[model samples]
Target chain A: AQSVTQLDSQVPVFEEAPVELRCNYSSSVSVYLFWYVQYPNQGLQLLLKYLSGSTLVKGINGFEAEFNKSQTSFHLRKPSVHISDTAEYFCAVSRLDSSYKLIFGSGTRLLVRP
Target chain B: EPEVTQTPSHQVTQMGQEVILRCVPISNHLYFYWYRQILGQKVEFLVSFYNNEISEKSEIFDDQFSVERPDGSNFTLKIRSTKLEDSAMYFCGGRQSSYEQYFGPGTRLTVT
Candidate 1:
């Protein structure tokens, strides 16, 4: 069975500060990784995905994540964040064979303080 | 910017009652999916539909749940009998190809 684990339940950061949300997955075979964001009272929005190619993948809103296959981790990072960046971040994984179903991690709440 | 849209931002229903959630995807999407997130829990996949039929479903999707694209434009998820445990945010998603499943604003279902 495939599963995702988000290290932090909540991350507090000041405005204009850098932030990193850690995620790890357990899977026997290769998988696809994704980052999603959900604002207050909104749906989940795709931030980025790692299917193949370079390990470093850039996503919307100046966010990026690096996929480490050896560690089975895909952590999301942002150099600078604004108050508007406060949201719930979720890391999801899907098996390469069964790509339709996404296994999501317990979301990490990003709290940006002004 | 095409996007998926779900109706009934919130719904409150009595236990054992039937509830239908509707979703409209951006034109030309070939696949549709349903997922749910209980409060303080990770989002869970329920089922996936393709070619007007169910392609895949999780264990969470049982006999009580059914999906249909009745009019070819509206994708609906029907719960035969609602339970208190069914209270959660239900999300509808659509995909044109392999990756990038676009999700809609979830419908918060509250079963009393």
Candidate 2:
């Protein structure tokens, strides 16, 4: 079974500041990594995914994540955050050869303050 | 871009009442799934369906919880008797084989 862990519960940052959300996973087999965002009272939207190839994956809203095999991490990063970037972010993982059911992290709430 | 859509964005029900949450997955996708997230909690998988049959389910999907694909364009989740703990945001998902799953906005259920 693959499991995901998001290290932080909340991250507070000022507008135009850089931000990072850390995520780690454990899986016996190869896995796919993903990031999702949810605004207040809204459904989750896919931010990006790491299927294979390049470890660095870019996503919508100027988000990017690096899949590091050595550290078992897939941390999301944004060079400069905007006030609209405030939302709940989740990290998820699924085995490459298994069912579509994804294991998700607890989530990190990004508070982009002015 | 095509995306999954769910119905009855919010539902309120009494204890022991039946509720059916509906979803319309992206066109041409073959796999479907249901997941739930209680307020301030992580999302949890409930079940997965493929080829008109349930492929897998979690312990949370008890006898009272059932899923069906009544037609080509719809997937439904029915809870026979709901408890207060059943209150949560339910998300429907879909994907083509060997691809990332797309999520619906979700139906929020509040059992009073």
List runs of model 2 lying over 4 Å from the truth.
Answer: none
Tens digit of per-residue lDDT, candidate 1, span A3-44: 899989999999999999999999987898899999999999
Q: C-alpha displacement of A24 in model 2, angstroms?
A: 0.5
**TM-score values for chain B across all models:** 0.98, 0.98
Kindly list the per-residue Cα lDDT of model 1 for residues B53-101, writing each as its tens digit.
8988999999999999999899999999999999999999888886778
Report lDDT (Cα) of residue A7, candidate 1: 82
Looking at model 2 chain B, report the run of 10 residues with the lowest lDDT sum: B93-102
The Cα error of candidate 1 at residue A105, in Å, is 0.4
lDDT of 2 at B96: 90
Candidate 2's residue-wise lDDT over B21-88, tens digit each? Answer: 99999988899999999999999999999999999899999999999998889999999999999999
Q: How accurate is candidate 1 locally (lDDT)?
A: 0.94
